[model samples]
Target: MDRERVVEWLEGGSVSIPKVLLKHYADIGLNEIEFLTLLHIHESIGSGNPFPTPIEISNRMSIDGTACSEVLRSLMKRGFLAIEQQDVSMMICEKYSLRPLWQKLASLMFETVHEEEEQERERSETDLYTMFEKEFGRPLSPFECETLSMWIDQDDHEPVIIKAALREAVMSGKLNFRYIDRILFEWKKNGVKTIEQARNQSRKFRQHQQPKQGVSSNEGTRKTTIPFFNWLEQ
Candidate 1:
């Protein structure tokens, strides 16, 4: 090509596509030909033409006009492309918009994040089940499993707090769900939503029950002790 022609080509400008759209086109259900056709439409819009004929778009692509027209129809059916008729100076003008495609891509990204979070939650619950079985020295009964699920799904307790409660039950020699449930209930009622808060609350209760110094064994066989907080008593 001549220098002038090369200069003109270089100055003709280019289409700018969002990286997300390019990366996730197929994930949003756009095939190769459909995506290419969409890009040409985007380019034409940036070049001051919101509406380009299928034949004109196809001339720059490998597909024929009929195939390009079908692709456009498919996009319309899939809610990815739309043609709007606008009144411009007493003339009706057709314009193509890809707003739906962008909206779908945005929803797809949200769903991907939501799916990952759900997977992580499932993994955490599985680990909790394993921990419970390990502590109890046997597989959880159906009722125990159901109770565990209820604690999470209905009560909305954090897994870490529940694990802390399990440790508290073990330390207190209360190896039963009823005792653990009471511990979790007491912690939640006391605003101990975190493991650290729960531990702090337990420590404070123990400290508050500290016994005063009394006669030693050598003097009168007297003893002193800090009382343990019985969650079941409450």
Candidate 2:
């Protein structure tokens, strides 16, 4: 190609396509011809002609008019294209709408995103099981796994809060799943939904108990001192 031709092509601007269309064209059951036909319609719309005739599309794409018509028919049958007649300059002309195409594309993209999110969540839940097994020094039984799943799926407890409760139970010499469940239950009952909240509650509980422990220790000391004095009097 000549430099001038290349410069002209470069200055002609670009066609914008949705990333979802590029990645999932085949997944959405669109053949190459059908995809190209859609692109031509999109370009026509950009060029201020919302509806381009089959001949116009074929001329631009180097395809025969008959083949372009077949593709358009197929796309229409698949609910991706629609035709409507409009009055243009007192003459009836067919106008094509690509709204169904956009709606189908949106649905496919949403399904793809939801599937990815579910897969990630499963992987995270698996990792939680692995962490629990390592901490407990044994593999979880079927019942234990069921319990964990219930917490994740039914109770809607976050993994971080559950892990925090587990750590608290372990530190208190109660390293069993039942004890951990009890801790989580109590926290949930008290509206502790986060790791930070659980930690704060634990700190407050310890602080509340410390004064009573101190008083008990002081009373024991007084009793011992009194016994020692009575022995001296004897």
Candidate 3:
């Protein structure tokens, strides 16, 4: 196929089947025909036809109508499918419900979801540690680790804000964690919780202490000296 044609084919709209269904269909006691029937029903529902008749399913799957009906019956008997009637313009139309299948899938996925969340949290903690080590230029001590943990777990300081405070401290030529902690403490006391707030506070402090131009004693030369961290003394 030409590259453009291949790209168009790949980008075309398609049905989505849950990975759980594909991986655990056999474990859930479904045979090949039964699984395909479920997939067809799911696709029909996505296409705005909630319940496809046996003939429609059979035509799509190239199976005989009788065989398709038998597979559907087996699926319904096993509590994986349901057929209900709904009034559409005063005509009863059959609607298919896959609630049973979804409920079973959710139960199977609960532990997997919990494990993924734990993995994500561990990865975030590792990234935070790496960031600190790179900034501090050495491995963290046990006490420093405990302090980081306390900031995260006990004080509820977000890692992003802690990193921002560390950056602020570095810019002020004080790279110690203690100095960063004091910066965080001052920010919290002043209700500065986000990086933007910290930045605004810093800008206000700088503007408040911006030195006025003065004439030198001898030659009337203009002199200006910028003050740093003068607000911290307050």
Candidate 4:
């Protein structure tokens, strides 16, 4: 690892993180020490060898073996490093750099305080794609994956919400990705994604329409029925 090259690399890029990555970084908020530890590993292995042992990194960074090992695992998860240890040397690669797509994800770990958020993102990104490919019997296009990422980032929308919206749109015979965004945008604005909120909204809407329905049951009943599960459904 060239100390000079490591320094140059760090200083060179503006670190224009992808939105998903930025969200992960902001949520995880890696401490300076952890970030520095990752940098050390990058320098120690730069274009030279695969993954270096914790002891080697510990010696160079002047840290304890245990501490270095712990941090190394953390870095591996957070996408700063990749680790593959076999009967031989461990292969490590930097994922957060301008690396290939596979390595890029390897270097990332969401900085979320809530474990649920971290798990949720992982589930949507990994499992959703896996399921999609399995069901369709074809891999999603890169652009399609990007669209999924966009949907995830937009509004902090979870897969559950997105999936529910998709089901609704499909059932209503209005399913379209573009429209889905608009629907989600509106749902988020109204704070009505959950079933309880939807139920509450339905009750209120029905209450508002009660008088009109009483006046003209024929016409008014149709309008009143529209909100039977308005909030919950859409």
Candidate 1 shows a clash count of 0
Report the C-alpha lDDT of model 3 over 1-234, residue by residue, as the tens digit: 599999998886699998888998886677888888898899899989998889999998868999899888888888899888889999988899998888777776886789898898778778888988999899999999999998889988877788888788778787887788887787788898888998988787777775767889898889886655633565
Off by over 4 Å in 4: 1-117, 130-139, 193-195, 198-234
Q: What's the TM-score of every candidate structure?
A: 0.81, 0.76, 0.58, 0.34
In the predicted model 2, the residue pairs found to clash are none
The full ranking of all candidates by TM-score, starting with the best, is 1, 2, 3, 4
Candidate 3 has an lDDT of 0.84
**What tens-digit string does per-residue lDDT give for candidate 4 at 52-167?**
67787677666788998898677666565565434434653432232332254444443223666777778776876675455446787887678777877766777766666555
Alpha-carbon shift of residue 171 in model 2 (angstroms): 2.6
In terms of lDDT, the best-performing candidate is 1
Candidate 3, residue 120: how far the Cα is off, in Å:
6.3
lDDT of 1 at 51: 97
lDDT of 1 by residue, 60-126 (tens): 9999999999999999999999999988899999999988888999999999999999999998899
Q: How far in Å is the alpha carbon of 136 misplaced in model 1? A: 1.9
Rank by lDDT, highest first: 1, 3, 2, 4
Better of 1 and 3 by TM-score: 1
lDDT score for residue 175 of model 3: 85
Residue 66 lDDT, candidate 2, scale 0-100: 93
Candidate 1 Cα misplacement greater than 4 A, ranges: 1-14, 87-92, 211-228
- Superposed by TM-score, candidate 4 places the C-alpha of residue 220 at a distance from the truth, in angstroms, of 25
Top TM-score hit: 1
lDDT, candidate 4, residue 99? 38
